[model samples]
Target: MSLEIRSLEIRIAASTDADAACTVLRRSITECCDLDHKNDPAILDAWLGNKTPQMVANWFNSPTNFSLVAVSEGVVVGVALLTGAGKLALCYLLPEARGQGVGKALLARMEEQACSWGVKALQLHSTATGQEFFARRGYVDAGKVRSPYGVETVFFWKQLDAGAEAPDGGKRKRFCNCNPV
Candidate 1:
């Protein structure tokens, strides 16, 4: 099933929006990413601990961070944050928002912002669930990273300023919208 995303809005997230964004983020991590965490109590606790509403709010208000939210009908369905240092720090979407192009919209906004900030490259740690999403956006895998919580993440990087060719200077095929009609 896909969401009828009429007029989805992507914008910078404000501190006051933290509560709702935190709910979406936490739910995406705990429920939407169950395939990776497997409902392990320790892993869930470790992952969820860092996403407290207050902490997320602080991140929203941080000077060195830029956060964005995707809203449809006034509800924030997805969230992403990028650090000033060019790290695509986080991206998460509610289960209902997946496969509706919300992630791609959020990613494009973040990448544009990064380019405007003079970022030459961008990097992110993607979960098993998000590996393909990042790949489709031209991110190349660097390798795997294991978190202290025992969850393994894939490292991905993309060159923001590379022009007329892929960062690796190889011919690249653009993503095709292959969803069946």
Candidate 2:
């Protein structure tokens, strides 16, 4: 079997890329999910409502949330976000970008950030379309949850900086020897 794999560049997202970020996330939630979810407004809102450009900009407020975009042929085709408290906010790849390692690379970037920030653990609420992908990356389902928008989601988690250092989300609460990201 063969597939055309395009060259991709993954970079930390700037505010300038917010629009493209929204597009990638919208496509991932709307175009990649199952028929039922695709048709359900509640699901759409739950999965992507808070991912718009303005919403993403607001997320940038805390300085803990970071966004990254994966570009292919100068087009934004994938995006991932990590929020404060080491939460994996959103991760999505365009249909054409799937299975081409874009998602994996994007996720690795977030994981690397978490490890560097002294984040003790990372978590995310995954949809059916994304559960397997997260599982493949050492994330295990902690449980299922319902989002504010009324959509059921699967929760996954990973631990980082286990030994002696972890950030308690404050300047002086450092418990372990933190690694620079």
Candidate 3:
């Protein structure tokens, strides 16, 4: 299903969104990231083993992390998490949401959050399938690293502009009222 990018609602993920966010994480890994896992049972299991709803809720509630979800027609289509230490820990989109700009929206928000937190640069370990996406967004390829799941992962980093502001000139709609400590 093709979705209009403007129609997606990107907001801070809440505990209530854990189940849907977990589903997005798992499905995106198992279905969309075939090249990284190669349908290997062991790899898939290891990668998805801890992606449970409870874990997602814990991530959402973490003071050191900023988590966001993209919703389309009341359904969560994508999820992303950014750490206080400048790590883009998670960014995944539902299979049908790929190439629909949802990922870009989630990423932009994460960058904004990073800037707000005084992060100088953002980094992430990208799967083979996500390398190009990060690259196109100006993330530089640092090198390759072996993932815990025994997969080759690309390391990407992007320097955040110190003066960066939201696209709306700091008037961006506030979806989540919680303040990041």
lDDT of each: 0.86, 0.76, 0.88
TM-score (C-alpha, index-matched) for candidate 2: 0.80
Best by TM-score: 1
Query: Among all windows of ten consecutive residues in candidate 3, which has the lowest summed lDDT?
Result: 172-181
- Show the colliding residue pairs in model 3: none
Order of the predicted models by TM-score, top scorer first: 1, 3, 2
Better of 1 and 3 by lDDT: 3
Model with the higher TM-score, candidate 1 or 3:
1
Per-residue lDDT of 45-106 in model 3, one digit per residue for the tens?
99998899999999999999899999998999999999889999999999989998899999
* Most lDDT-accurate candidate: 3
Q: Write the per-residue lDDT of candidate 2 for residues 1-181, one digit (tens) a residue.
A: 2334568898988887778878877877777876328577766676676778887656544477787889987888888889867889878888777898988989888877877776777899988778899998777788989767665789998655545342475343332345634
What's the true lDDT of residue 63 in model 3?
A: 94
TM-score of each: 0.89, 0.80, 0.87
RMSD (CA, Å), each prediction: 6.0, 6.2, 6.4
